[model samples]
Target: MHIITRCEEMKIWSLRKNKTPMLHYFLFAYWFILLVWQNLGAGGSANRGGMDVVIKCGLLVMLMIYYFMHATGIRRDILLMCMLLVGVYAIVKIEGGLDLSKILYYFFPFLFVLLIFGVGWKFELNKRQLVHLCNMLIVVVSYIAVYALIFCTDQFANAFSIDNAYGNELKSFLMSSHEYGMYLVFGIMAIILCMEFDPEGTKNRRFWYFLALILFSVNLILTFSRTSILSLAVLLIFYVLIFAKKRLRNWFLILAGIAVLMVLVIPSLRNFFWEIVMKENNDAGRDALIDFGMAFYRDGSVSQKLFGWDYAPIKAYLASSRGLGSFHNAYVQQIVANGLLGVFIMIMYSVVTLYDIFRTIKTKKEGSHLSKFFISFAASAVVFMTFNTAALFASAIDSYFMTLFTVVVPKYVNQSIRAGTFDVPIKNRETRPNVRRVYR
Candidate 1:
């Protein structure tokens, strides 16, 4: 009886109500499973009436409901507006409109960030804790990645049998190496924020974070993803060269030395590095796809240019003519999907976010390290989404993850600043003025 009572108490303690529900961790778990399943081409689709669709949507609805319970009028209004805006935009005037899978995969997580972070609801944890929590997620995922590379192999990350690049490609849990690249994007972004927010974190914590960053960087290299690498490079340049603290900058230099040594010592690694730099992945096939897209766009009528034939017809036409569905270029995908309107909306995704981020950064110059991370991210994202990397309208999970950072994350961070609810205590807080208004 005593043992049973103890067990029951433990369970209750774990489930004790917090604004950040532990169940959402399970939601992340499901997302990981989805990545792995999709990697293996075994994942279900909405058309097949897959349980993945039901469970994903159901979990999101539940998360929203839980937040609504504690929400003030403002929170509810924001949540409702998020739902309606995403719903109406994603559905209205599109081919095969109202794809639960698309909305779930592409845009659903955008709103969830608001609930956990601040705009829609506040987790019991402070902003510093929340940011670290996110970084720790990368560390956990990196551990799994190590295990998968060793024990699972081709099941997690695939062996590259491509024409030019010859090595193991890291695409664990997602369909493409490029998508996995964005996973690293999220990891690196979190690390940047954590380091800036808490540069003197415990030695043990710093070690673990450094380890996670190494793993993420190594896999990013192995992925041989050009745009992803370029995006990260820009961020590193901005941070390490321009804004990094002395201690952090030294560590970066040390890593650079190590990378140089590896290139000199390891022939295969050297060749692989050389190949990525030389743009070995470029080919005529990609060019053809771009050509087809431009030609199709050029031939469109005025009405089609304004409203588009939606993405379905483009996919169908591409399949019928070229035997490939995607244009392999994000900008081209926008041109064909919803024509000029699609192109404009897609551009606005980055443009508006960049404007917001810089506007925030401009106001935060006085002893504020918080803006450094956002500046790094905004610059990197613009570069990443510009290539075959995944534009906002590309229907790739990369795009969705990017949106979470570039759009939703910024909004909430701004909200937290204005409300004075974000509790990230900096070592230099005493030197800076109180948080000022983030521009509209």
Candidate 2:
């Protein structure tokens, strides 16, 4: 057979075994594109450039395709239709026909994820074949984390034409200033990598995973994104405390490594770390943005205040408010644009999700730490928004992190473990003579 024919045969064999090559490739592609987006910004070769647009459109198309292929019954179809309708309404109300960054990049992913996966994507990911796909994804993400830490440059700073001083400080750790949002996504990936590649459990894989974490941590500090840093910090702490077996030893070493790294490689990072905890000067500016954001809520016209001044409105408002206006808070931005209803819907959805996942964690006997890590990442993302406004927005990396954690990771892990046919052993009453007596 020709080489092409031979390759096709292999592909067919893989698919026949129930392996999802497309989804694995897609996950890898997403991770790779995110790395490029973070490092290369939104310009350049058509394939790599305008990736923010590509990611949104690609995700929308992918999810829609997945929905049609995987749709179960009438209920899912109806729910998806309603979601699409709401998205369309919000899109029209916000920008009519997808012209604004806020519409295409910010809002679409949420709608797409909700419609495609909300009904039962969780069940779809339960297959063993799908779990292997997820493991492949985690490996790919670990690779990206390591790559981002080592090769990433200040390309991001020059892309946005941000102030040189800030660039000088930030560019060293960040891949791209223009795509700092993606950095938060990277942070989420790092958490997953850690969860899947546990040291004691996973054996040799632990070394690479630990290295991945260090690289990610360094990148987070170097990126100087308060949101990413804080999110990762919260996530790591949760993972170590709740998930890490031999908890005291594991956490102590992890903390010691971080402390030593701060002391040795970059002393300045210690200050940066503390600054995160204390919310210092630079942090103060962010709070001021919130204050001003709230003022818009308190002082703007009823419509502007209630319906949200919109991104454009904020630019217009800012063009007048000391030559600038920004809805620097994401939740506030939602309240401003969609009114209390939009905000309430968002809160309700998030609360429901958290409750469901936590319940799932409690009931499922499989990987509790993995579940906790997944939950922590998702929860951390929701909390991260209080510091930065992009958590709800499509283009903002926070939403990506949220979707990945809430929708992707859990489904991927659960399905993979289940698919592997690894049974969670139930104690057999026959084996334990005292079991019945104890129970009685």
Candidate 3:
């Protein structure tokens, strides 16, 4: 009787310990669902006036609660700097007499950035928990893939159909094909990281990851996004080069060579590649846009040049000139809207983040799982940001992935330092190798 009572007590204790994380997992699922639904036009089409506001407000509350529950001391400086920038921008916009509602709309995305970092700071995951998170992501992507496959069969079948210009692209109920591509790429990258880091797992884990890779890869290709495809390809190459064992790297090189040879030798493959990747002169107008933005900045008055243009002014200018609002390139957009000071701030943020990653790598054990995953994620993010604007100042899903790595990397390093897992010495090291590592 005593033994049975002890076992029962232990079971209850285990359940109590797990309850919070389980709740977190469910909350994350809900958050992800909202992200997808918002991108899917469900919230936009159904509740254009009020539902969207309710959803955003509700999500903001949930994020705040979640952050408080799991918040840690990591990345407080970055958070503060971000908040400072937002405040400055708000002041500038308000001073320029921009619409109050528009100002709030512009500020909303930064809040998501804060929420993401908070989640990352407090994210403590055991191997099982990490696996569970990956599984949740995989399931979401798979559902999107299947939905697109089933409902858009005719679109998929006729790649060049004139019926719909985007018939070949797999939007997957998303607002745009590019958005769908980004989500697929992010999902695929996460699965790849999980598979690489946690290879020796439960039965058939590798198989499942491999299957998911193929599925997401196909879906990504179907999106027909040149930038996303390039980003994914670059990330994959970096992953193998940086993380793979010597023998594995050799095999990867050989496979890459074979793929290139096949593309060159096969006529149909060459034509397909040319049509999909090489035929599009996507950069044709981008240079002109950059030039125009620079001229506009140059011609502005002293105050206008210093602060650049407010959102309303920029929107009006674009409407009158090109009938399109975006500056296309994030760097150019910042220059046009926020001037040199804004550009400087952004550069500082990127430099600090990159420096943090560099410092962590120096202290981390060679081939450490955390280091490899962080590097892979950072590579993807850097590439994505270079060619895309979603992660720059938008509260899109792509931005969340970038924010996740920034927070998670610091948290991992902090934990490792506390545990003395880092290879570098904590104390005087002049007598040792002249190497220093710090997370400032």
Candidate 4:
């Protein structure tokens, strides 16, 4: 729980009012490398133990080191805060009489996020650059989509067992469908934002973006991951009710009606969708995991509850269950991995984020209609990560785009929305601050 979050305000959320941006051109190459590495199918071993982890962590360290040469406000504060976290973690291990070498495996992987936050915390971008970033995210999805097409041609070809009803789940290159599903959530949102914000002067761009959006949605559904599906559903509802245009809402409703009609009229489709939902709806494993986690916490020593055990402590349970690994529940997973203090920090982070989002909705400027929209995306993204994902630190791709959208890009959009600059004519723009204006 030693987040030292008071330090969050020590640096702004990386939003600056500068007209010219400090470009990190290396990011594009970095992201492309991540994309290829992930889809290379090296499996979790590659991700967790191989040079992949070293390369990622090393690249981030280099970036932060370079950043310190010119860093001032947010970058410095955020990096120092991250160092504070590492200090707290090390102190807990040393004071708790645990071997730091044994826990280093658990500790080092998390440094990637800390390093990324240090570099990205105060990173700046113009509106056009943000749109380009989102476009690149869409390209990530497009690559995955094509990969899915090539591999999951049957959509149900990769059956687990004869007894397993949820057959042929689309995992793409990922071993778990949920990871791919989570990856698509951010990609889907990126497409939506890009569709709304990307330059419109280019011909047929909307058609292509919309087509990609449809494709991404289909792939997500085919993942058949309950948590991911629910996460996307919540995000879509937030978009429609809070930010979408009336016509768009109506269109969404119409599409819903058509989808329902097709499901009802087609017996096979209805059964398939129903089976996807009910496959493990009554699975007792999750409840049992929760029971075990709570029981362990209640019976453990005070130190144990403060910092979790290095091991899963559920190896017996794992031996009996088929394909079941760690706890599927994120909160329980956090409790087992980092202990009660970790869960407390996680919950407190969400509380802080939601409170800030509430303030954003309450204090929108007169003409900043999309402020609520931007805040809604940020809020839903935070909620989805806190409740659904097993880890708060995202994959390399999601880390890049999510940080850009939630923390880096919103200030520009919210400000331009307030100035009415996006919708205003070019002649009226002289009165506004000298910064990038997203023209409608």
Q: Give per-residue CA lDDT, model 1, range 1-440, as digits (tens).
A: 12212221111112222233343343244345445444444553323355556655665576567655644323444456556655555654544564666555436534654454333433333365446556655765686568656864653343233335434456664556777777786787777677666566635478777877877877777676777788888888777876787898899999889988998799876665666443555663777778877888788887666645556666777789877657877777766655686577567555765665566566654333454566677777777756663665332445645655665556546544533445644332333221234333
Task: Mark the 10 consecutive residues where model 3 has the least summed lDDT.
Answer: 9-18
Task: Give the TM-score comparing model 3 with the true structure, all chains together.
Answer: 0.77
Span of 10 residues, lowest total lDDT, candidate 1: 4-13
lDDT of each: 0.59, 0.51, 0.60, 0.58
> Candidate 2: misplaced stretches above 4 Å?
1-41, 44-55, 74-110, 117-122, 126-165, 171-204, 248-281, 299-307, 316-326, 393-398, 411-440
Top candidate on lDDT is 3
Q: Write the per-residue lDDT of candidate 4 for residues 1-440, one digit (tens) a residue.
A: 23222323355343323232333344555556655665574455436445566556565555555554433334555556557766766676555365433344345434544443444433334445556667777787788888898867777353322244455568887656766776688788877776665557334587877788788888887777776677777787888888889999999989988988998899766766666644647553667767776786677677667876554335446547635666656667667667887677556544544554455456565434445556656655555454343444433454454444554355444444444454543333353223232333
Which residue ranges in model 4 land beyond 4 Å of their true spot? Answer: 1-32, 41-48, 74-84, 94-122, 156-167, 199-203, 277-284, 311-323, 356-368, 374-389, 394-440
Model 1 alpha-carbon drift over 4 Å, by segment:
1-52, 66-126, 152-163, 166-168, 199-201, 246-270, 276-284, 317-323, 365-367, 393-396, 424-440
Cα RMSD for predicted model 3: 9.7
lDDT preference between candidates 3 and 4, better one: 3
RMSD of 2: 11.0
Best by TM-score: 3
RMSD of every candidate to native, in Å, equals: 10.3, 11.0, 9.7, 7.6
Report the CA-based lDDT of candidate 3 relative to the real structure: 0.60
